[model samples]
Target: MQSGLALLLIGIQLVYAGKHSLQYFYTATSGLPNFPQFVSVGLVDEQPFTYYDSNIRRETPRQDWMAKSEGEDYWEQQTQTLTGTEQSFKNNINVAKERFNQTGGVHINQVMYGCSWDEETGDVDGFDEHGYDGEDFFSLDLKNLRYISTVPEAHITLVKVNNNKALLEQKKQYRTQECIEWLKKYLQYGKSTLERKVSPEVSLLQKSPSSPVTCHATGFYPKEVTISWQKNKQDHDEDVDLGELVVNEDGTFQKTSTLSVKPDDWKMNVYECVVEHKSRTIRSILTEDKIKTNYAPVPIGIIVGVVAVVLLLVIIAVAGYKVYQKNKGFNPVNASDDGSNSSAHSDPKA
Candidate 1:
């Protein structure tokens, strides 16, 4: 009995130690602590390159024209090499695309062009001029930019989970230390193979709450997300409320929403958290209702205005034909007279 008890104690202690270790890891891997958001430039075949960040915005030393030119040339060479490496990437992407066609996830065909350079500020005005029309590469609010290394090359992407409520529900089963481990693994493995150079670190962390809750959401490619709630088997009659989502450190998004309901509603009905993205939806249902409260209907004035504009257009189109006919000398008496006048005059002469 004593031996069995001892083994159990050892197991418990090991689990405890593991929890703390993750906490320490989570704190350290979060990025260079207090590293003022700043730009870092490296040569990609001698092209002028600039990385924009809060730190760079505050203070980036002015560089001379000759030095900048040399840097740009280096950047250009590196870029050419990277561009050449696209063969393998293209193969991978083609494979991925085939899979996507079968089960659509993300498409690489959307990538028209991408580059990296050395100068503090080099504009391939030409590159910006074409393609990448609706896409935003840099994370303005997070102060994070895509960076690849000189060695194996790098590509990192973050895909938002459609099942946020389920994720949050799973989170509740975790303790503080377990949560730390989860964050670390999520940051480490979730990244693409191309971006292996980046250290396993996350600078900022945000998470969603349980049940009909609200949180920010974002993703790398163009994505649309919807927040909604339902009661019992029927969808909720109340309006679902939402807030703007922001980009996370790993390039995914975080969004929030709120659900307010009476305490009695808990056992009375079920509440669900629904998140829809890219034609897929993930949702979680909980006993408690937490969707946003007291939402107002869409403004009546806007609806009225839209209806009025449609009506006015219809009236104008219908009235235009009458005005056109009048301008064209349309007369019933003239039409009859023109057709029969010649016949009548000829018969009278005969």
Candidate 2:
């Protein structure tokens, strides 16, 4: 009988020693007690089982079972199995969460964080890890066993909590790369359509003698558009600086460009807007100003009336002067009875 009691004590000491060793190892490796999660006894199976206090990294001993008359080796084996099974179950749960989240399912929160499982015979016998929303579910299979879960929304918080942080960070970088690729693809998709576009309006900002004419041309599909100015048939060498390209929410690109050159180019030259993207090339140009002339009826009437009044006054004055000359018959040089004597005197009229 004393031998039996001694064996019981020895078994208890062995289990305790093993538990402490595991606790120390977990703390050292993971920096926390539970490697993954802390499952409860209530949710575990009724079979000869073990409950790992994942938070404390320890096990809850069944007092009645340890007091049994089973030999010390037998009891010791049970203890090892219980602890080992708990550790193994935790490891599996971690792996399952990792693989499931990788699938990009919306229910990753429940699938990864705060998950639950039953450990029996050193394996996860049963597990339930999600709550259902209207549309989605979560489940996993290992060998012949499966654990199923249903959840409504992707539980982001839970994902952040139980997620493998190192791997999660890597996934963020991967997502960024994917987004960049998507943008490049979108830009490439409509390259041909954009290149074939023409803007309706051409606006010249300023024109001066010394400065380059700054022209702003607006057009559709600006991603494939190129703006430039031309003088006499030659491409202008002035710098063309493009402004920030704004993309609208509706998948169109809007952009602006400033072309600088001597202001004399604006007088009679053609400024061209060039668009070249994928499969097409299009251009719009504005050339020299077209002159216009207009004559009004009222201005013509006023000019004619002024000319007639000036001519009538001049005719009356000339007639009066001729009559005065005829009446003044006295010789302008001297007075004489006959015009013959006027040889010495000139006669105005005789």
TM-score of every model? 0.27, 0.26
Q: lDDT of candidate 2?
A: 0.29
List, residue by residue over 1-350, the lDDT tens digit for candidate 2: 11211121111111111011010001001212323332212100111112333344443433233234234554354334334333433343333345445333321111111111111222111111222211123322222222223332223323432243443332233223332332233224433542343442334443333444334433343344555555566786567776543322222334445566544555557666554433355454543332111212442243344334321111110000011122211111112221221001111110
Q: Which window of 10 residues has the lowest lDDT sum in candidate 2?
A: 313-322
lDDT of 2 at 87: 42
- Stretches off by above 4 angstroms in model 1 are 1-50, 53-222, 237-239, 288-350
**RMSD (CA, Å), each prediction:** 31.1, 53.2
